[model samples]
Target chain A: MEPFEGKTISWGEHNGVIELSLHRGPCNEIGSETLEELESFAEVLRTSAGNMHTLIIHSVMPAGFCAGADLRELYRRAYQQPRTSGNSIAEVRNFLVRIHAVFNAIDDAPLVTVAAVHGVAFGGGFELALTADLIVADRTARFAFPELRLGLIPGFGGIPRLKRDLGNGIARDMLFTGRSINATKAQTADLVSQVVAEGEALRVAHALASQVGKFDLNAVRAAKKFIKPVPHAELLREIDIFCELFESPAVAAGLRRFVESNSPLPYLP
Target chain B: MRTLAQTTDEILTLAAQQFKVARETLSPNDDFFKTLGIDSLQALSLLTRLENHFHVELPDYELQDVSDFGTLAGRIQARL
Candidate 1:
């Protein structure tokens, strides 16, 4: 198979298992370029669905799997002058919509997907990892939904996917607390399928991918199809709620404080 | 609005359903994790259900030391 490289993703297929490595900024934040690359990558997968039995999304950068979105970008956009303008609002809305679509495509793909996560997977990063059919994390991996700290919510269908995996009770805890859960705790919660030693996430993910890839493509696809379909309406509802929250004064104030502090958000007891 | 006693009763009922034990078998003094043979994640799940049922967001810090059913019930009751 031909090796494929994009601005943010490098992927190749071997034995029906495709390894897609995310490489972006130091922490692999999902910026606009990364989103565009994912769009193209999804198209490639769509065309090769028949030959691809499994996919593993891992990170090549040592910084982390993904630190979520670019905080700088978020701060810049949130604090930009003329925030009330229709053009600015429309642009932000479209960006979120496009992101949700790509993530949904990944979630709805016929092929089995796995996330090989190590280091920090926060916000959008955590949501992306949750999209996979299975998650394999290293002991060093940490997952959280810190969006609420910034006066935002998980907009990329993270909340609904989390609810599906963990039910509302545990899911809301992660959402409300914005606290990180280690791989061991996540495994106990049944959020992670396997937890390997540090630096072994990719290797374990490859093994799992190979096992899944060994199955007949038809049966694999059929199994995925037979499973319950995601309630897409919920995702739409989440996006709508996120966009509305994004426009609120509270989010603006929160972003201002975050930018000014230039440090972790403090918790007032 | 439910009375404190009513809320406590409801919380116990919810815990019974979640932990899959007879309500009669549990008391307010029983440690939640010990009784359920569960962990923090399970506790978090219970907290989520309580939040949904009560329509309030309980602080995680306030819950860190709550190990028994009575403390958990009291917290929920206070929030309500």
Candidate 2:
């Protein structure tokens, strides 16, 4: 794919493996453009799903894998006086639904997927990584869900994913404290499959993908299919609760303060 | 309603059960995470249990720095 100025991903295929790198200058923030590209990419995968054996998600930026959602976009949507696109609030709510669908597409893809992470993967970024079948990170990688500090929850299907992967306690701790977890801690929590040396995440991930490619494609796909799907009902419920909170006074005041302060918001501790 | 000491004893009992240890093995001043070999997630689970038991929602922020049984009891005492 051709790399664009504001684009967040560039993907290529080699030896039945597709490697996609996310890049957005300093921090790869999940913005509208990134989501649009991912939507289109998911469609492409749907049409050519059989051709790929493994999909490796990585980051080209040095600062981090992704710093979660674009705060600017969120602030605008949350605090803007009038509907910017002449759409109703219900229409605005579709954005969350759209994100869930696209990420779900990736999660449900026929090919095995891996996330090669480094630096920081916060909020939605961590959610995206969790969608992968496996995550291999370097020592430099860090993960967190700081949305609670903003009085917003992880609206991009993160709650269900985290709850499924790490159980309710760990998920709630991360959400409530808004603290970052290092690669070692993430591995201990079983969120990361492997922890490599600094700057070796991509290499290790590619090696793992190559090994996975050696397996019988049918067996690999079948194994994935055998795993149960995350409860769709629960995911929808999370989105609903988050949307309700998004419109509450707490979230509104939090977003306004976040924008005004131009710094990380304070939690109780 | 439970007194402060009663609440503390109840919390310690819960903590001991969660860690699968003897009640006497834990002390009021012991750091729950350190003594119990539990992480923050386990601690959070204990917090949830405490909430259900005491019928109070512990403020996540105010308790972020709380580590030991004594401090935990003091926080609960304040709430009471």
Per-residue alpha-carbon lDDT of candidate 1 for residues A120-162, written as tens digits (9 for 90 to 100) = 7778899899888889988667778878877789887888899
How close is chain B to the truth by TM-score, in each candidate?
Answer: 0.89, 0.91
* CAPRI grade, predicted model 2: incorrect
Q: Model 1: residues >4 Å from true position, as ranges?
A: A81-86, A264-269, B1-80
Q: In candidate 2, what are the lDDT values of residues A135-166, reduced to their tens digit? A: 99886677788888777778888888887778
| Model 2 lDDT at residue A14 | 86
- What's the CA RMSD for each of the models? 11.2, 10.8
- Over 4 Å off, model 2: A1-6, A84-88, A264-269, B1-80
Clashing residue pairs in candidate 2 (N, C-alpha, C atoms within 3 angstroms): none
Clash counts for the predictions, in order: 0, 0
Kindly give the stretch of ten consecutive residues in candidate 1 chain B with the minimal lDDT sum. B39-48
The number of the candidate with the highest TM-score is: 1
Tens-place lDDT per residue, model 2, B1-76, is 6787888899999989867999999889897877888744345446655765665546556777777898898898
Best candidate per DockQ, number?
Answer: 2
